[model samples]
Target: MGLIFLGIGIAGTILPVLPGGPFYLVAAFCFTKSSERLDNWFKGTKVYDKYVEGFRQKRGMTRKEKIRINLIADFFIVLSLFIVDILFVQIIMVVLGLYKHYYFIKKIKTIKPGEIE
Candidate 1:
């Protein structure tokens, strides 16, 4: 199960059609619960440094990174509007964006890139 998530995540990172970080983070978490060796191996990867470690350490993305992520999400949401025309669905997407921005602002600690806590 963990490996499946990790594989999808690695593919997602390159594909751009799927959100990679969340899936990878989920995989890391599953590995944490299931296999210490796998978790440590994931920690050693560059992907872990780029996506998960900061949040895991309670130091979140820089504001610029937050903006970048939200913007990308917005872009995908808006694009989906073309294919999924249900008004309720559109509203849900917009709400998801709002919640994401709120999460970044209120929950995650803003950090400077490359600054270790």
Candidate 2:
């Protein structure tokens, strides 16, 4: 299940409709809960290695990067909601999407690429 979320997250990178970072975070959390080995592997992954390092090092994301990522994510989410037109569900998704953005920002603010544990 964690791996599935990770895969979806990766796919989400290309597809504007999917949520990437949240999925990755979910995968990381699930891996930690499910298997130590998998958790280790996830931390070792090249793509996520920086995140793990940053998290351990307590380094923050560059302001520019944060703004760029937030803009892109917000744009996609709004576009998705507009196209989907799910009304109440879309509203909930908007909140969740904003929450995910906040979570990413908070994580990036605290973690630096060089700080992997």
Candidate 3:
């Protein structure tokens, strides 16, 4: 299960349509519960270490990071919506995508770099 989530997360990182962080986070949590060694390995990973740490420490991303993420998400969302031919569904997706971006930006802005709870 953990590996599955990790794989999905990695794939999501490459594919703009899928979400990455949530998958990685779920994998980490599952690893922590099922195997100490796997948890340790994940914690030691450079690519994922900081994200796990940030979540564990209850820290948030910097303002710049938030802005960058929002911009990227917005770009992908808009691009995908534009390419789709369905008008009503496309409009709904656009609204939902923007809402997701805004939600993350607002949630992440609450924590700055190094400001761990």
Query: Across residues 1-117, which tens digit of lDDT does each residue of candidate 1 receive?
Result: 679988888876654245567788899889899989988898898988888886677557788888887677767767877778799977776776676667768876788877867
TM-score of every candidate relative to the true structure:
0.69, 0.54, 0.72
**For every candidate, C-alpha RMSD to the true structure in Å:** 3.7, 4.6, 2.8
Error of 3 at 21 (Å): 2.0
Candidate 1 Cα outliers beyond 4 Å, as residue runs:
1-26, 44-46, 114-116
For model 3, the superposed segments whose C-alpha errors exceed 4 Å read 15-18, 113-117
Ranking by TM-score: 3, 1, 2
Top-scoring candidate (lDDT): 1
Candidate-wise lDDT, in order: 0.76, 0.70, 0.73
Q: How many backbone clashes does candidate 3 have?
A: 0
Task: Tell me the lDDT of model 1 at 26.
Answer: 91
Clashes of each: 0, 6, 0
lDDT of 3 by residue, 20-109 (tens): 777888998899999999988887887477555665567566776667756776687778787889998787777777666776766555
Report clash pairs, candidate 3.
none
Ranked by lDDT, the better of candidates 1 and 3 is: 1
When summed lDDT is taken over every stretch of 10 residues in candidate 2, the lowest stretch is 50-59
Q: What shift in Å separates residue 60 of candidate 3 from its native position after superposition?
A: 2.1
Instruction: After superposing candidate 2 on the true structure, give the runs of residues whose Cα lies further than 4 Å from its correct spot.
Output: 12-19, 22-46, 49-58, 105-107, 110-117
